[model samples]
Target: MLRRSKRSSSSYYLLRRIALAAKAAKGEQSRCGIVGRSSSCSCSRFLTTGGIDDGEDDHDASTSSSSSTTLIKKRINDEYVDTEAAMERTRMKAAALKAAGLKAESMTVFDREVKRAHRDRAAYLQREKKEEKEKKSSSSEGDFLLEEATRRVLDRLDDIKRPFKRILVIGGATVSTVKQLLEKRRDVETIIACDSSEATLLLVKDIVGDAPKRKFDSFPVEIKYVQAFEDDLPIKDNVVDCVLSVLGLHWVNDLPGAMGQARCTLVPDGLFLSAIFGGDTLTELRIACALAETENEGGVSARVSPLAHVRDAGNLLGRAGLRLPAVDVDTLTLNYKTPMDLVEHLRMMGEQNAVIERRQTIKRSTMELANQKYVENFSALSLSNDDDASMPKPSSSESGISATFQILYMTGWSPSETQQKAKERGSATVSLSDLKSALEEKEEEEEKK
Candidate 1:
């Protein structure tokens, strides 16, 4: 009997272990049975078949046992259902928390990345500004050198001797040159200086001083200042004996019209002498800007235009109806230490103004970036071997702020014998065939090139 009891205990323990294992595999919590004991006695009763002793007692006992068994089975099923439901709720809560944490981390990373980008952009803009200031200083210096060279050349021309009765000086700022010429020519009876700026005329009057004016006696000289545009000199045709201009024609908006007025003002044999700053004045600055834009890999504003260089002054003079026209153009180079210094000189000389239409103020960041790019691209080429290897090198034109310019000096007479002959030939007729031929020729030339 003791051995039989031991075997029964073993069997009960094995059955309980199997039930627990099944519940755990389904993600359910452990639960006690209806018997309120460690072993599953009620479950064992269902597995075994047995008979009753007396009829009435058997009937009552059997019914009671059956009812208890049914109650136990129902309790076990309920316990399993509750355990599974609780586990599912817990799993869902954990997943929600994890998702929220990941979202917060992503937001933090995104904010940091944005801040880093802004800081880098600001740094780039600052670097660009420094470069721009350096470039401007170099440009100004070059301009000063050119102006000085021009002054020297003018002085040489002043030494020549000439006689004149009537003289027209175009452009008013050059009052000093006119004053010197007046002092030299005792025979200059009447002088007219025409210019667009009223302020310039006033300055000229002050510079001329109180030189006595006479009509006919004692080497009479009369200086008259007229406010007029280059294209429309307020003088009658063939009224002046000589027309002279220096460093002013480039300012004229209408070069052709100005030339016509100049020609009309002079007598048939009247002389015309003029000097103009032609296209090559600021080649270095132009080239550096272009190269910098290419290096930066960006587009630049169209406000800057390449200055027009005169290819043939003789042709232009002839087109203006000048006789015995002679055009001579030469290049001049000038240098400066920095761009800012050059700009200051231009201001003093009243040449710092620009004609381009623009906004009153530029974006600080954009300007800074432009300057940096300019310096980075052009600084190396501007250096010279003589520059100290240890010392910091400049960004452009190693010979300080060097600039190249073309000085177009021209001399001619008003419409004379040759001009009259051409006028008499009447307008040269051009037919539709001629127009077609000209267009075809241009296209062929372009293709060949």
Candidate 2:
């Protein structure tokens, strides 16, 4: 009498377990009547055997088969349960991720907006550069202002009696500054032109022709072009003698970071000079858009990118590890034919709004009303100025609207051994009391006068 081994595989006992317990337990029959002694699962021999009824053995075999089947079923059920639980967990995680994505509002931020502005500006310049080149005159009003700013920086350099050897122009609009420097500051040896927008860079031909061939100091001035973000200049530390940006820093998201990089790129006593639009730029358009949106769309959206304050520029420079930071404002009031004309000029000049969280679309009515309101409120059109024939007009002054573009100028000098340094604690030559007395004496003299 042999019993099946308990350690047998589940597959081996699977069929035996699936059968009825009574049938599987059919006991040891005669080995002589058409039966093989080695057979473990088949029950045909039980019925075929001659007159040997082992009912107890048959019951035991049936029980063993039933138990084996129950064990296999239990294992299958456990695996199925585990698989279902894992699937459920995966579904829950996916749902959570979807909800999280939906919850994040204002998907665009300032940095992303600036990057977009640069990319689009590049594309735009590439498309219209030929037209621009053909129509180029003494540059636009904005360009004139940038040139003036660059001149101011050059003058400041003169006042300091310092000469720049290597200069980096941080924005495409300031490419003229390089030529201006090369012509004016003959000591300058190299010029690095960097712009985030390739299209903007393409416009460099208008400012700088293939003309570094005009030698300086027994060698041709070196000209290098690199596409780089303001916050991330690709130059060695203390390599550039000056960093100049014109009508450009206003578009940067991280002004302080960019300024810091400028400081890092400059040699000791190097100068960082830049001019950017202040918060007052395009005030009329911003107001008109907000008013129209509120009147028509029930709420207002960001229609313009906010510019920086001149006051904040000084702090930004100090934080960038520069010395003697200076910030000042220069406001230029320009007249336009219409608000739309002003907008067109901005587009042409690559000054499109790069603000994140801007309105995806403006309603037709909203835009129409905005334009109407702009004409009514900002333009110089009186009731009598209306043409009943609706004749087309030429030039911006026809509609006669004025927009303010406030330019903020910033200057900071890279650290040098000769530059004035703050005195350490108790290191001053004069005591606090002595300084107070001197101030009092000065006030007394003024009062006496």
Candidate 3:
């Protein structure tokens, strides 16, 4: 019974070996050079060449053969190596993708940083705009007050009674009083109104309204409107008798050039009467901004450019070849319930527009903080003054506002020889020291008055 059991086990093992060999032979046949079923050059034929046949004795001999065992072992080893190589290729591909993903993440971070920088820049610009609006509001309020003061001066000038032939009105839009004065004077022959703003010219035309034809029949006065800059007046040299301007000269960016142009356009004996904002124009606002910046490091702190710094003005006029230049400085105090209200008045008067270089937008938060700081500082300072100091002596030209502005009124004439001389070699030169001296003298005169 033991011998029969052993024979059965041997037979099972032989059958398994034969099956595996047949599978390998079929796989080789599919991949080998053998084409037809009749071909003897197949793996099956090659294995059978060593005197092996399909029988019980042959099968037992094949199973015991070392060559067959070694072949089977080699095939199993090759299959294991192929599986491992495939797994290794898949792992390398996954690692490469992870590295690429990390690089993309780094690029996204850089892009976010750039966008943040742009947003910061935009915020800064908005803040600048708000501050500019505030400045314009203040300037407009000051201008209205100045117009009233100018009216007084005009009344005084009219009372003196000087004869004038041809009156050249530069920046005629803002000088309504001067225009009225010329219209009333019968001796005035021609009024040449010059301005860059077409809207202003139209307004001036409306004010005159056929009066030049009706009132002055004897002189037949002509009102000519010239659209020109201060530097480029479209008129004959040495032809005008008097040039009048108010709240206009400060808008000219190239003051010297504009002055030189004015000199060229004026007659030898022509008088130039002008009023402009000066260096001390917005003293209160400037002080407020400075105090705010110092107290809360969050507010904007930039110096406001004076309407007309006296030294610069005098120098500019002298450079234009004007003689007997008399510069007079005056302070006009105006009262405003709030800073924002003051700004609205300026907008109404069309004086809210700033020069291109000074133009900017301001942030709401910055402006609110600045206003609060200003109120605190102003109140504290006003209260600190001695109560017995004679009730804060009233100035010559004081309005209701707590703030005051210094405006410079200047009058000068073109040198008699300026018309005859070459444009380059004319009397258009004034020393800086002389201009400084003139401003100092004007300030001193104001104090004495």
Candidate 4:
């Protein structure tokens, strides 16, 4: 009886091995990357070659003559392999563009914007040290809004529990965020800063110190520079733990597409934060320009690029497949002595007019009239103590005016299993009628109280 039981147990083990091998082979047939079913890829063949399962040869090839289902799987597997190979080749070629290539066809104005941004940033880097000295001497400031917005986003890092091991800062290559990251979180291990211009990355070396990898005192942070377009990121999916964009994403031709790329690059539940100019930005200037141009040229030309509305930011984030998206605005009302002062400040911030439809130059007559209209419409009083007067009057032509900037800060997270999921359709425990009745009862209880 013991000898018979032993024989039966051995037979059962052999059958189980064969069953598992067959099941694995069936699963292998449906997946991508078959590539003519090399022996290494097919489970049945692998098991056969390994001397584990000798009952079956290559399942599809051997069974095709007798089985219709086998022939169909073989055809589907071939197609899947071919499709996967083509996609991989295309993806590699896309990554190659970062070194020397082109933007995607969907990004219409992106190439042009990239060129302008590079030119502007290159000039800034070359003269940054000299300009700082000059700015100090003249008591004039620069890029206050950009730096301020960046720091504000940095302040929220405490809220994120996970360490950002791989960080991608899009369009903020010149402005180094490494120092702040090192100081705030010692968990930073790798920071990949990318921009359209090589010059910006060149200057970043100076800020972050020499070599590709930078060490902040004792902290270890590997920083790499890549010349990449905003819309076309040469990065693998779900590789980066964090993505940050400061005053840059708004310039992309296809904002939604860029956001989608960001979403894909981030790991599950990874953080993405950005601060961009909202539609309300430069309202005074937009209004003044329209009023001036309409009065003079009988129509308005494109003096400034159109900014995105705050209402649309949440929808855009959601469209990009990001979960728990949040959008808010911070209005910065800067006091400039004149409208031209605001223009100079904008130039210093690298915010020169780069829109494709922008006029070569605002007509001198239109420009002067716009300034006059701006002062009349938005100028604030520079209160001064007068010996004879109780209160000061409105600011003169030389007095300060308010230049409004609505910085829209948006935050989103990459999809994760732990995040809340919406209930399936028709699966709700309570019906609409039940919810209405419950609300009515609550309202009645409130009335009694």
Candidate 5:
């Protein structure tokens, strides 16, 4: 017999294997009986008549099937491994994020206890000063800022036509706001004065004691004092008709939470009003201190407590579930003979930095350096004309440093069915682009008439 070519022999073996596999897949036969081309098997004759080496063909066919099976298994294992790795990565990332959130929640910004202690200490120091004085000063020189803010706050209350039977005041340490509310507002029958410091709350007791005999005698309104943190009020929900906080709220570490708590005390359609120190309150002092610290210590520490910005006040109110939110600003600049006088004024106001990370004491060298910077950069020869003409005017030749206090006055109302709701978007029949033309046409008609 003639020897077959290597390519033809391999092709014939491949055809024979395909026939065997197909028959096995159909379950026609469990085994193929053809061991070689010479065997008289029916499958051998039908598969291929070409002459070929049986031994080598069997070896090659077995090797090809085993290799294909191994490749398929390897591919399946690779896909499974890839899926497991991705899941592990996702789990690790989720764990890291959860830990980071917990860390952020535990971090302290403004220490409420420290701030309360400072306010209490200030109250005691003021009492000592009063006991030593021969006569009480008629002018509230140290508390003029608070007085101005109080006046503005009351003016806003006056604009509202509705009467408030019950009012809650937070951080009314000076007690001027309470006196004004009792004297002016006939609708106000009960007042709840609250403060973080127990000593500060004690100051409101004078208001309670003198309520019956003073100007409020004409309208006997009940005044009660409560020692409570701004962030955690003791009052029940929807108890007060109006809530007022003057120069407070800024010191709270969790301002949004505190504002929500304040809102919770208000009744439906109740008012939420406050005057907080804006971010620009102590611009000059902040800059001077920052520069001095950077020059001396090669780094800066928290010398001033962070205050809210005018732009953010409205959003904060809405976030606390208040409606009809409004925010405005009132800026005041005070001229100080020296930076030290400014420091003393802050101490009197109990507005010293209570940040948890603040240094215990500022260095004498840094203080001197900051004073130099303040005078050099913010010196004013004469005070600018201000609306509050009662403030002492600087002499034409005298030079002093100026400090700016930007007060943010915010007002928000509790949600109620009676409150006005904004019109839906794209529901207007007229477009603002045509407003000017419409106004012009109306003016023409008016002129013709």
Candidate 6:
């Protein structure tokens, strides 16, 4: 009985080994490279020989030894070997991405998935913070820029003096902005708020729905929420009367595609007003990070996401098929007590590095190095009471960190016959030089009179 039990146990063990080997052969395999060791060391022998060694194998008596070995060898050669080769090719491609001093010039610079995750996390944290305080505040400190941008953009809507029945608010919404929009825009019957993060949508829905009494009572606007990316808006084309995005378009990987979609969503002659971070936004931080990473790690990665230049706004509008596009820049410089404060503010704003090839983690030493570099290179003297009023005042510290945010305000209208169109080329009735002379003659005649 004891001899029979031992034989059965050995057979079971042999079968399990075969099963695991077959499974491994069918799936892609990966091994992390250890310090001072090759990642493919253990698999090197198996890979070289093509199959399990006969001396180490304990096969079933009923199975033909040569046939079983041949089957396993074929599986490893066909599936396992090809998978490793493919993985090697991918590694080579990734290595090429690590070239020093190379800018993130590709269209695939930002990872949309990472951006979505960060926004969701940021929204969750913000909600938790508000709950901890047991009060619904108008806005948080990090959201100051967002609220300001929304206010400025919405103010432009007043200049048009037209009623918009349905408005699409791209990006997320804040408490103060929602209140301001509701109280100001009496003609807005519906507001469709779209964002990439589900948590953001839920939080905004709750806050706006539970706003203070009389804040939105008189306006009576219907606020709706949709979860979608900025570049890939899911709404039907030519639906909304207006599309407004504040401090949101900057994160889009394809700004032109996003703008094109926005134009298509607007009704004929509908307004498209937006504010995005310009190219020079956070120039100080970007430089500091680059220098620090180079000094510490012997290479630089995209610590700060790239932004569109103010000059690109007009051209992007033209590409998006919008009419009468106007682009302007608003530079907002803030003085922080420390560089770390600025970083925290960016996190609260849900604007962090989301580059696809970015390092998974930033070392503590690297952050310290970056902070020192930021202070050494970008620190400015605090403005006193006697200083010029136009200049921004820094914190109480002797030397305050300067962080610049360049906001690009863009306004475009959908195509319509009622809108003014430029005349065809060479069809002008008067020449520019002749018109100038006529104006000068008119001025002389007026002087004689």
lDDT of 2: 0.59
User: What tens digits encode model 4's per-residue C-alpha lDDT throughout 1-449?
Assistant: 00113443355456547756985876543321112111111110110011122223345443433221121132111211122232354467567665465655533543445354534443353445445767789642224555566766776666777678778787742463544565566577777666665445545544545433333456546665544566666556777889988887877777887888888878888898887889988888889989999999999876777778989899889988888889887766666777887775565455655676566666788888888999899875343222212322222334668766787878999999987877879898888999999999999999999
Deviating ranges (above 4 Å) for candidate 4: 1-115, 118-126, 129-142, 172-176, 211-217, 381-398, 424-449
Best by TM-score: 5
Task: List all candidate RMSDs to the true structure.
Answer: 43.6, 29.4, 39.5, 22.8, 33.5, 18.2
- Specify the poorest-scoring 10-residue window by lDDT in model 4: 40-49
Stronger candidate by lDDT (3 vs 5): 5
Clashing pairs in 5: none
Superposed Cα deviation of residue 66, candidate 6 (Å): 67
| Clashing residue pair totals per candidate (backbone < 3 A) | 13, 7, 16, 0, 0, 0
lDDT of 2 by residue, 339-362 (tens): 776665565455766666665577
TM accuracy, model 6: 0.69
Better of 1 and 2 by TM-score: 2
Q: Write the per-residue lDDT of candidate 5 for residues 203-231, one digit (tens) a residue.
A: 54533344332254576666555555676
Error of 6 at 421 (Å): 1.0
Model 2 bad stretches (over 4 Å): 1-108, 111-142, 152-155, 205-207, 213-219, 380-399, 422-449
Please give the range of 10 consecutive residues that has the lowest summed lDDT in model 3: 40-49
lDDT of each: 0.47, 0.59, 0.49, 0.61, 0.66, 0.65
Better of 2 and 3 by lDDT: 2
Summarize candidate 1's per-residue lDDT along 1-449 as a digit string, tens digits: 00113443365456547755974665422121122111111211110012212222222221233332221221122211122222333355456657677433332211222222222222222223334667787421212333343353345445445555777777623554455555455567667766554334444454454353432344535565544445445456677887777665665544655676788778886777777777776555555544445445465432232233666567667777788777766665444454433333333333322333322343444444444443444332343322222322233345345444566777777866644343345466876789999999999999999
Ranking by lDDT: 5, 6, 4, 2, 3, 1
* Candidate 1, residue 164: how far the Cα is off, in Å: 2.4
Where does model 1 exceed 4 Å of error? 1-162, 183-186, 212-220, 292-297, 302-308, 352-399, 418-449
Please give the RMSD of candidate 4 to the true structure.
22.8
Tens digit of lDDT per residue, candidate 6, span 411-448? 99999989999889999988999999999999999999
